[model samples]
Structure formats: structure tokens, C-alpha cells
Target: MDIEQIRKRAQEIWEAEGRPEGQHERHWQQAEQELSGGGELPQTSSPAHHSATTIPEGRGKKKSDAVPSLGGEPGGFQPGELASKKK
Candidate 1:
């Protein structure tokens, strides 16, 4: 790919990461990999242009179905029971 494109993408990746210190090489390599079709790069956008369109449906909804009930006991253990039982 183009060196200029890699440079631009690296700059974007650096900025998107909050401009951390001492990460130039890492960002450059990541940009190169993404540009070379190694992986998809995260999309960056201005706050004004960011909207719900970028988020999937039920993005903020709590997924109760994914959680299993523990019968009101934390970790499914009684208050005085040992965390690990001996054989």
C-alpha cells in the first residue's frame, strides 16, 4: 500500500488511542497490517458525526437472559460455606 496512506492511518490510530506515549512504532505497524488487509481497523469519527447508527440494536440493554439465577446466594454458596469444598 501507499506509504502516505500508512502514515495517515497510523496517525489516526495513534490519535484514537488518546495519543499515548512511546507507541509510534506499534501504531505504524498496526496501520500497515490494516492497510495490507491483515485486519479491520477501528473506525474513527468526530463526536458530531457519531450517532446510534454506529451502534448495534440493544447496545445498552442489560442481557438478563445471559445471566443465571443463583437463588439469592452470592456465587451460589451459603453464607458460612467454604468457597472450595475438600473431597
Candidate 2:
């Protein structure tokens, strides 16, 4: 998402959460999730993705794990690419 979208979503989250303290980053993260289409449906996969957690039936919304940086990609990376590459 862009700066404007992130800022807008972050503000929305901050306000929704009653404006808690020490959670600016968290709010920003949730904002990205919101503006970046976090709630979009994910396709069911094969056994490899079996272990992946699925959102509950009534709780299909996806939440962001962390806040992206102000600029650039915010350090996006795969968790197990090295191990898989060696195989």
C-alpha cells in the first residue's frame, strides 16, 4: 500500500482500538493488512500448506504479523527458502 493508504488505515486502527499506548507499529501493521487486501480469500492448497493456519469460519479476516517500514518493501522474506533451496 502507499503512504496515504497506510497512514489512513493506521489512524483507523488506532482509533478503533481506543487509542492504546505503545502500539503505534502494531496499528500501522494492521493498517497495511486492511489496505493491502488482507481479508482476501486464500485458496486451499495441497499437503504442503496443510500446516498453515486457516482463519475460522466466522473469522476469515487476515491480520498482519508486523508493520511495514515507512519506505521500500519493509523487509519482506520467506521463512524457509534457504532450506528448500538446498533440497
Candidate 3:
């Protein structure tokens, strides 16, 4: 994508992230994904634009500490948790 488009998207992400620090890479990737319409990105917050981490923006590790679920409970979880049978 062009620099301007990417820049705009990145800025949006950064803003959604509460203007956090040191998350340039993450923000950039997220912006790219959204702009490119890559679809739901794993380990990424939905366009709801909220980071799982509640530690505020500029502390450290700007992205949410919570694990991003494609469609399950948020936060840490085991693989087997997705098992779909009860035998």
C-alpha cells in the first residue's frame, strides 16, 4: 500500500491503542491488515479498536496482554479448550 494510506491506518491504530509507545511495528502491521482487507488477524484486536492490555498506552508492551481469540474466550487458553465433543 502507499505510504499515505498505510500512514493513515497506522495512525488510527495508534490512536485506538490510546497512543501507546513502542508499538509502531504492531500498529503498522494492524494498519496494513485492515487496509489490505486481510481479514481477521490472529492475536489482534478486532476493529473494535481496543487493546486487551489494560496497562495503559505508554507503560510497556503497548498491545494488549490478553491473548486474541478468533472466536473464543479472551485471555490465556489451552488448545484443547476448543474440543467440540463430549464423549
Candidate 4:
């Protein structure tokens, strides 16, 4: 039901079909299709979703330990709140 599960399942299917290298896009698409019961998964926003860091700014760099700069942003937002709000 999660992205990893979907990805693993997709990889298995892709390999079963014929483990052709460089077909990552096809594997992901097929995986999303199967996971969504033929409906489209929300199109991937970017490669950030699959990378180690959630932020796209630092793709291969180590995350800094410095204090985060919220820059006058409002507080009281809990984890998953923003995503839940969208639903």
C-alpha cells in the first residue's frame, strides 16, 4: 500500500516480464498502475520522492545539522497535517 511496497512489487513484475535494464520508467509506471487498480497514481512530482532526502535541494549532499530556517513561517503544523489537509 506504500511506495516501497509498490516499488518492490513493480520490480518483481518488471523482472518477471523480462529484467531489461534502463526500463525504470516502465517498471514504475507498471507498478503504479497495478497498485492503483489501473487508475493512475499521482504522477511523480520529481525524483526527490525516491531519493534519501525529502528535499530536492540537496540531492547527494549530507543533510546539515544546523537549525532549520523557517523564516517567519507559522508553527503548530504537525507531521502529515499538510498532506491530510489536502484530502
RMSD of each: 12.8, 21.7, 15.0, 14.9
* lDDT ranking, high to low: 1, 3, 4, 2
lDDT of 1 by residue, 1-87 (tens): 999999999898879866767778878888889889987755443343455347688676763555445547645744345657512
lDDT values of the candidates?
Answer: 0.70, 0.59, 0.65, 0.62
Q: Comparing candidate 2 with candidate 4, which one achieves the higher lDDT? A: 4
Clashing pairs in 3: 53-64
Q: After superposition, how far is residue 72 of candidate 2 from its true place, in Å?
A: 73
User: Higher-TM-score candidate among 3 and 4?
Assistant: 3
Give the top-scoring candidate (lDDT). Answer: 1
CA shift of 69, model 3, Å: 39
The C-alpha stretches of model 1 lying farther than 4 A from their native spots are 40-87
Collision pairs in model 4 = none
Q: 1 or 4: which has the higher TM-score?
A: 1
How high is the lDDT of residue 3 in model 1?
A: 100
Which ten-residue region of model 1 has the weakest summed lDDT?
Answer: 43-52
Q: Write the per-residue lDDT of candidate 4 for residues 1-87, one digit (tens) a residue.
A: 689988897678666655656767867877778787886554333343346545577554864445444434665334335634544
Please report how far candidate 1 places residue 33 from its true position, in Å. Answer: 0.2
